[model samples]
Target: MHFDTRLFIFIIINIINVRPNFGQYSDDQSYLSSIEFNRGGSLTNLIFSSPHGGFLGANLTLKKLGKSLNNETLTTILWQLPVAGCYNDSLKQCVYTLKDCLQSNNKILSYHPDARCVIDRSSTLSMYLLTKAIAQSFVSHYHPYTILNKLTRQYVDPAEDLPRGTFLLESAIRAYIDYHRLIAIAKEAIRSPSRGLFIEFVFHRNSQTIQLGYGFDPLYPSTMGKPSESTMHELISRSGPSVIIGNNSLGYFLRLNGFEYVIPMEQSQQQRQIRYRLSTYSTRMHADQRFNAILFSYPIERLRKHSIDQEAKRIAKAIEQFIQTNNIKILSSFASSLLSVNRIMRLCVLFLSQSFTMLYISH
Candidate 1:
């Protein structure tokens, strides 16, 4: 039986807050500028649009993709648009020249960027133009603090040279969600929508480190920091003692699967040792350190055999103690958000047990 008490609370609270129908905002979205390629060179056949990866191009791409998906003719123009160098006063062609080149390749084109780690929405394919449309919609609906952003920042690389700090995957996810939603809408428009056309869209990550320069500086952060993404050949995957780890879905899956598996976190495709986190809804819980590496060290397996709720209460107590002693947010609301069903309940119980954190809860 799925005693997902903790899961229930999140389902009731968090999921409802997120607007999956991102495409609804299509009419309002706008863009800042465009990319420019060399005037002389023929545009590359393949296209590689990075919804999230480009550090410099991300903001620009969002505006462009947003405008394109909303208009049928504009979308077609962008698909065929050529470009030279990105962002400058210099003369050139279309900005999406690189993206078109990647798309022209004989084999299926793929994209993955490391710096933008959050829940990858575009990770999944969609029915048609619908996917891209909804992706634009989602980006339009949400915005971060200062009103400049559409999505909230989830991960912050402490080592990044840039001064900005925000969730990397938030905007990407909004667009992805919008894309799929558009696909759904387009199909619904059909006199008889096709079932086979429904494509599964799973959030994922991709890496093309070799394409980018390998030289690294201690002050700069790159995906290569993880030991697994070192070589391109090592990208292959095999079922073994090693298990994927990152956010709550993993913690729950690992708890369900087996304990002996290696606690290695890697993206599905870039199956190297890259520690990426996405849709870690549990991080919203009260315990500050509730969903970090401590998850690997926790004694969850032994706790599972007993009444799941009882054991969850115990784990919550231990986590609560750790939080209090550390003088962290005794009421860290989003940290342990993805904990198991019983775990959330147990956390609330533990919260009541703490005299100091207790005063805030009741008020």
Candidate 2:
């Protein structure tokens, strides 16, 4: 009897360990599904959002969305300024191959390499700061302290609708939804426990994505739009009344009925970029010269298409190793070792770096 009980306990542990590896999204394709939540009858709202991704131009009519060749822009770029953004010639021409690859591979590597300075500046690195900004709406308008004007501030926060004057930009939210909707939802025992928990999808792909890869992208839309959490502040601001604090503190989560504020937590989505760096320069994905190459590889577009791209293999190995090692699984289980909104926080760093680059470009 003792041996049988031990074997049953062993099987349960193995099942829990195996769960995260299965049922993930393919990067090549896109789909939609609903996420149900338990608010303990407190009326939890669902705000499907996508932040570090963009799929507005992607089409359902096409199996794999293909971007146009953009060498004209690159070749026209002055050598003095330096070139940016990946310009793939073959993928630009071969739609069929792109489709087939998307179906089989299920991942798109978004290759645009523009620094955050050229983009926007809100970051997700410091959870307290982001939450404080959400609580107070006093952070700089462009985020990570970029864009310090009324127009930019109003552009990010539409004070007319949400009172808190904070919102997750719908575009960014949709992108987050496009990739992570299938990933974030946990299963419900009250509704349909028999289906177990449905896993959220990861929108797998090796295509050119946005370059909010370091503490570089602070002005990326989601960070910018997070200020409008409550509908009441926007109302008070317009009514010619200052927002007053009722209690000693001033943080409130019940500020909106329909906003895309996610529960802040961190995860490692940059495993690909990190591994590529380790191989190319005995480097990591922090600020450096080789970091840009690992980012764009815009320099080596033709080299990536072949079946045996070292970068892809390296990325695959890192992911496989991340899976095989007990460390990541251990991190997932611990609460004290957590970083709030980990993936978004990493992207926040990427966005901030972009802001620095933007200032350089301006100078």
Candidate 3:
């Protein structure tokens, strides 16, 4: 046999063995179905996601979705700045082949070498956080963050409604459905006579404060307060917030952490309503009302310039302390050991560094 033929056969054999009956898939298809949904470790009642950290453009899919290749939101958020968004042509063109080879096919992989900074919570390192969280929780989804730039009606504004087939819009709807489903699954997991906490991790590129969203509305009329055991509102915020707290105790938590945060809701009723809607959905979504949620948002900016790993360790430590301080029981002994701040920091750093490495390789 020719040398090329032998090499080709070897490649084919390996691909078959690894994929197992999966044959002939486009990069986008492979990514959307498998690479995108990276659930590291086990199904714990914890999830860490960075939806916009994805560098692969799904250019073909986005084109079909009516997104332009040059949308500003896409640029600003994903390919915009030199520090965090997409930076060059290679990342603009999705390349996962090298990434797949590097990871050894055992884990989920996302590749975009030109863009390393997509914003945290909008992180490319969500999978790492998810993997780390699984050591403790019962179920989790660590997600990569990617944006479909031209899906919105306005190129510069992300707040505008996205037209159908727009990538981000599709992702948003999928997430909405997924979160509801996750909540349902988590409810069952939490109810099995096992004490568990549903922890969701998010990224916040615009702020320095790590906001722990518990769904308590301090301004909610006294007559209409969230339930003491409420994790429903908390879950909604975990999925994503309507508004970040700007003032009050929650705001104070940011200050305590040596970070700055804006309390938009504290100052304006309009902002409050905006946030309220962003955090909680209509009662029609029956699943959201039944459970409580515990979520935390980290600042992505810190990852770029500071030893934010120390801060991440601090957050993990705080959670451990919170659990012990309140006598919360975690089911797995493995989880108990993994809950240490040092371990969590290591896992978080590993994922972030790997994701960043994939981007730099393109340069």
Off by over 4 Å in 3: 1-31, 34-47, 54-191, 219-224, 228-291, 332-363
Candidate 1 Cα errors over 4 Å, as ranges? 1-65, 68-306, 329-363
lDDT per residue for candidate 2 within 1-363, as digits (tens), equals: 012455446544554443212222333332221111111111111111111111111111232233434312111111121112222355542221222222111232222323321322232212222211221221121011110111122122221112111122333223334323232231111121111101011111233321111112212335323322222222222221111111110111111211111111122345223321111110111112211111111111223353223333332232223223211121232321232234345554665576567667777
Better model by TM-score, 1 or 3? 3
Q: Give the Å shift of residue 151 in candidate 2.
A: 33
lDDT of 3 by residue, 156-181 (tens): 11211232112233344443334334
TM-scores of the candidates in the order shown:
0.19, 0.19, 0.38
Say which candidate scores most in lDDT.
Answer: 3
Q: What local distance difference test score does each model get?
A: 0.25, 0.22, 0.35
Per-residue lDDT tens digits of candidate 1, residues 1-363? Answer: 223466557545644453212222332342221111111001101011111211222222222222222232222211221112232224333232223222312322322233222222221111111223222221222110010122212222111111112212333333443333333343222211111111111122232110111111111235334423221111112211121232222332433433333223333444343343221111111012111112112222233254434433432333233223332222122322432334546555654455445455656
Indicate whether candidate 1 or candidate 2 has the larger lDDT: 1
Worst 10 residues of 3 by lDDT: 144-153
Candidate 2 error regions (>4 Å)? 1-178, 186-212, 217-309, 318-363
Ranking by lDDT: 3, 1, 2
Sort by TM-score, top down from the best: 3, 2, 1
C-alpha lDDT of residue 321 in model 3: 42
Instruction: For candidate 2, report its TM-score.
Output: 0.19
